[model samples]
Target: MIMVFGIGDYGLYEPHEGHFAMVGQEMIFQGNWITPHLNGSPYLNKPPLLYWLIAFSTKVFGAHEFAARLPIGLAGWLGILIAWKWTRQLWGVSASRIAALMLSVTVGWFLFTHQILIDVLLSTLLLASNYFLWRVIYQPQSWVYWWAAYISLGLCLLTKGLIGIVFPLLGFLVLGLVRQDRKLIRRLRLFRGSLLVLALILPWFIAVEQANPGFWHYFVVNEHLDRLLDRRFPPDYEVSQISAFGYLIITALWCFPGILFLPSVLKFTWQEWRQGFRDRASTLERQYSDGILLLAIAAILPVIFFLPFSSRLIYYGIPAIPPYVILFGGWYSRYQTSVSEEQSDQPLAISIKQSYLPANFREKKRNKVVTIYSAIAICLGICFVSTLFFHSLIVQSLPPVINNSDTKLLMFIVPITLGLGWIISGIGIVRQSRFALLPVFLALIVTYISVVQGFIAYQDVRSSKTLIRAADSCLNIDTLWIFEGSREIGTAGAISYYLNQGQNYNAKDIAEHHDTGWEKGNSGRIYRHVMVLSDGGKNRIPPNFPGSPPAYLIDRQQLQSYWNSDRPVVFITDFLRQFNDLDDPENRNLPQGVGKPSLIINNRKLYLNAAAQKFECNF
Candidate 1:
C-alpha cells in the first residue's frame, strides 16, 4: 500500500515541507549529526531528534518514502498500546479496550500515521508521559514510574519543543488542585524530576546552539514565542481575528463525534461527585472516579492553553483526543450493572429469595430497549453531522468542469457511508450488544475512506517529481542556473537539492542585478543559461531588466533578433495568449503573428515556461 501510493515521491507542503527530509539527507551526506544544514547554512526551525531518527531510518531502509513514514506509524501504534495499558490499570479492561479502539481508528490518527510529519510522534510522547504520570499518581510508592515519566516528558520536549512538557505539567497541576490530593502533590519530587527532564532536553539545545550561533534566538524566541504571541510567522501573518471564546466554540464544533458526548460525560461526572466521594463507594468505583477526573483534566488543559494563542490549527489539538476517548469510555463503562448478587438466607427462605430476586423479564427487556434507543440516536446524530461536513468539503472542492452527475456521484459517497454506519449501530442497539463497539466499526470505515481520499488527492493535485525531473534535466548545463522570482522555499529547495545533488546552489532574486563578477566574459557570468519557471502573470519579470517590452509584445522578428544576441535569455511563464485573448477578437492576432508552435506536454500547453527550447529538447 505504501509503495503503491508513491508516498516517497511526495514532498512536504510549502512552509516547512522540505525541512526534515532535506536536513536528514544532509545528515547522511555530510556525516554530521550535531548541526543541521540546508543549502550549507544553519537550519534551526526544529530540534534534530526527528531528523536523526529519519536519518538513521533512511540509512537502514535506504531512504525511501516508507522509511520516512515508518516512525510515525509506529509511534501511533505505540500510543494506542500505551493508552490501552494505562486505561486498563486506572479504570478497567473494558474501558482500556474501548480507548485503544478509538485511538486506532480516529480519522486524525489514521491520516497523520501515514505522513512524514512530527505531530503523531509528538502525540505519542505526550500520551506516554500522561500514562506514566497517572501510574505514578495512583501508585506513589513507585519511584521508577516517576523516572519513566520524566524520561517521556524530556523526549516529548525533543519531539516538539517546550509545549510538549508544559501542557502535560499544566494538566497534572490542574488535576491535583481539583482532586485536592495533597499527599500526591507534595511527594511529586518536582525538583529532582524537573532537573532530569532538563538534563535530557538541554544538551541538544546547547549543542545545536553552540554549533550554530543565533539558533536559540531564532528557534526559541522567534519560532516559539513570537509565532504564538505576535502571529508574524512563516507562510502568512494575517491572523484570524476570532476571540478566545470564538476559538473555544470552533474547537468544540470541530471535535465532532467526541465533542457530542462531552455533555453526557460531564453530567455523569457531576452526578458521581454530588453523591459524595467519601460517602459510599467501592474501591473499584473510587479508582474509576479518579481515572475520569484525571483524563478530563488532561484533555481540557491543552485546549485551554492553545485557545489563547494567536494562531490556531486543528492539529494542535491532537494530543487531547486520547484522553477525551478515555473519559468517554470510563463514563460508559460505569452504566453496566451486575446481575449476580446473592440472596439472604432467612426463616422464610422463599419470601427472602423472592424479595432479593432480580427484576421481571419484561422490565429488563424495557431497560434494554431504552438503552438501545439512546445508543442508536447518538450514533445517528454523529453519522449525520460527519456526513454533512464531508459533503460540504466535497461541494467546495468540485472543479467547474465537473458535470452535475459526476458531482452527485462524488457527493453521495459520504451519505452512503453514513447510512451504512447507522444501520450497523442500529443492529447493535437492537441486539442489546455493545454500543461502543458500533463506534469502532464506524471509525474503521472513516479511516479507510480518509486514507483513500488522501491518496487520490495526492495523485490529482500534487505533482510528485516535477522539480526533481526538471533539475535532473538541467544538471550538465555549464551556465549558472538562476532561480528567479520569489523565495517560495518549496520550489527553490527541491530544485536546489536535486540539481546540486546536495551541493550548494546559488540563487538570485529577479529584482537583484545579475552579478558582474561571476558574469565576466560569458563564462564568468553567474547565470549564462537562466531557467525561469514562472506562472507568467503580469509584473512577473523584473522592472530593472531591459527586455523587448515583455514577452507579450515580442513579434517573431523581434524574437528572432533577440535570440541572435550573444547572451540568450529564456523567459518562463504560463501566459497562454490563446486562452487570454479568447475574450477579445481584436487582440486575437497577437498569438498568430509569433509563428511559434505552442509547446505541448501530456496534452497540455506548457504554461510554466516561456523558453520552450531549453526544456522541450531536454524532456
Candidate 2:
C-alpha cells in the first residue's frame, strides 16, 4: 500500500520518468511494442521489458501516471515479498518480517517506487534469481528451481540488457571460488541452463533487430561497452555518475539506519570467525556460514563490478541492497533471542536453527539490545538537532532550483520523526518489551511517504506537467509547438504525450536532418537535429504526431521567422536558463517580433505567435 500510494498524485518526474512514460505511451500510440519510439524516432537505448509492462498497464488503466507507475510498484512489492520469503528460509519469521520492512523503507527502494525507473525492477528480478539459485545450492536435485533461476536471469537480461546475466554470474563465480565448491557449479548444468536463458530472451532480440537494423551494434557496443568505458554517444549521463567515495555514500543512504548497525554485525562476525577456527564446526554451522558468505558476496559484487567504471550512477548499487538487509535481519534476529552468555562462545548458527525466542532469553539479552537501541537513538537525536539548527545552511547550500520550502519542510520532518521513533523504541528496549523495533519501522515508512509528499509539493518546479497542460489548452491542430533549449527533453516529451492524445503519425514520413550552415531561408537553424518528423522534405511546416503539430528545438533565426509568421506557434523555453534571461536585461534574447510571454508557470515561459491569439489563453 505504501509503495503505490499517491503515485498518480503528481506528474511523471522530468527527464527519467517523463522519458520512459513517453516511450511507453508512444508504444500504444504507434501500435508498435517491439521497437520503442520517442518523438516518432526509434529509442534503442533500453530493453522493452519496462516499456512493455507500462504499455500493458496503460491499456488496462488508461494513459495516465497511475498506469505508468503501477508496474514498478508491483515490482517493488514483489521484491519485498521475495526478501521476506528468502529470509524466512535462512533465518526465521521474525527476521523475514524485519528484512521485508527494511528493504521496503530503504531510501532507494522507497524513492524509486514512486518514480518510474528500471533499477528497482532490475534489482528485484536479480534478487529473485539469487533466491532460486540459493534453493538449487541446497536442493540440487530440484531441477525445477534450477530452470527457475535461469528463467529469472533471462528476465533480468530483458529488463536491463547484459548486466542481468553478468551480475548473477559474477556473484556465483565469486561464491564458488571463495568456498571452493565445484559441486554447485557442476550441478548448474551449464549447457542446459544456457539454452534455457537463450530460449527466453532471444526471440525479442531477434525481432527487434529485424525491425530496426544496426540495433545489435548500438545496443551492445554503444549502449553497454561504450557506456561502461564512458564513451557512449550523446554523452548525456556522464555528469550524473559519482566518485568512489560518493558511491559508498549513496550505498549508505540507500541502506540508511540499518547500515548503522554494522558495528554490531562486525562484532558477531569476528566471534563467529574465532569459533570456526577453535572447533570442528557442525554441518548446520557450515551451511549457515555459507549462507552468510553468499549474502555478503551478492550484496557487494555489483559495487565491485561498477566501482572501476566511471559511468556508475548512485542507484547502480541498488542490486546490492537486498542481500545486505537480509544479512542484517539474520544477525539482528540472532541477537534478539541469543543465549545469556557472551555471543563469542556460541556458534551463530545455533540462533539460525531456533524458531522461537526462549522463555528466559529476555533479561539476559536486554543489555545488548538496549545498547544497540540507545546508540541508534543517540544518532537519530543528533541528526534531529543538527537539522533543526543547520537547516538554513543546508537549504542555502542546495542547488537554487530544488532549494524550496517543501525541501526545507522535509528536512525538518524526517529527522524529527526518526529521532522520536528511536527514542520511544529505546525506552521499550530498556523495559524488555516485545517488538521494540516496531516504532522505528513505522517511522521509516512515515518518513519516506513524507518525502514523496514533499516532492509532489515541489512538482511545479521539478516537473513541466502544469505548464504542459496550460500550453495544451491553448494549442490546436494548426498550432505548432516549438521547444527551445538543448536539455528540455522532459518538457518536449510531456508536450508530445499529454497534448497528442488520439493522434497518429506515419513513421515512414519522419526524417532526421541536421543543419550545418547558417540559415538562408525561413527553415530556422536547428541546434542539433530537428526531432520532428517532416512532411515531404518541408521543414518549415512540419506534420503533427499525436497531440499537436511537430515540436523542434529551434535556434534564434527560426524563432524570429516563426514569431513573425502568420501560422500559430507556441514556444516552450527551458526552465532555469530561460528564467535567468528574464532576470538579466542585457542577456535577454527575445526576438523583436515576439513580445512578452503569453504564459509563465514554474519558470517555464510559453511564447505565442500573433496568430495564436485567436484562442483565449491564460498562464
Model 2 over residues 350-423: C-alpha lDDT tens digits?
Answer: 44343333233264655554666667776676667567787788879866656778778788888888878787
TM-score of candidate 1 versus the correct structure, residues matched by position: 0.70
Candidate 1 lDDT over 1-619, as tens digits, reads: 3212334545443223344655665576566688765433445666777888877876787645556656676787887887787666644666567677666666566666656668778878887887777667657789898998899999988887877788778777876776677776666677888899889978888887777666677777766887678543342323234566776765554344456557766776555433225556444444445555666666777677778776765566667777777666655544432222111211111121121222322235557534655576556746654676567567667653342454555456556565566556555544545563565356446545544554444431232234344534543333233332222323333333444333332443322533311211112112222233232223222211111221222333443443343332332222212343444332222222233433332212222223334544444
lDDT for residue 522 in candidate 1, whole number 0-100: 18
In model 1, which residue pairs have backbone atoms overlapping below 3 Å?
518-524, 518-525, 519-524, 519-525, 535-574, 572-610, 574-607
Off by over 4 Å in 2: 266-287, 338-373, 389-415, 429-432, 488-491, 501-561, 576-592
Kindly provide the TM-score of model 2 when superposed on the true structure, using C-alpha atoms.
0.83
**What lDDT is reached at residue 20 by model 1?**
63
Regions of model 1 farther than 4 Å from truth: 1-11, 179-182, 231-256, 270-276, 279-288, 336-397, 400-414, 439-443, 446-450, 459-464, 470-491, 494-612
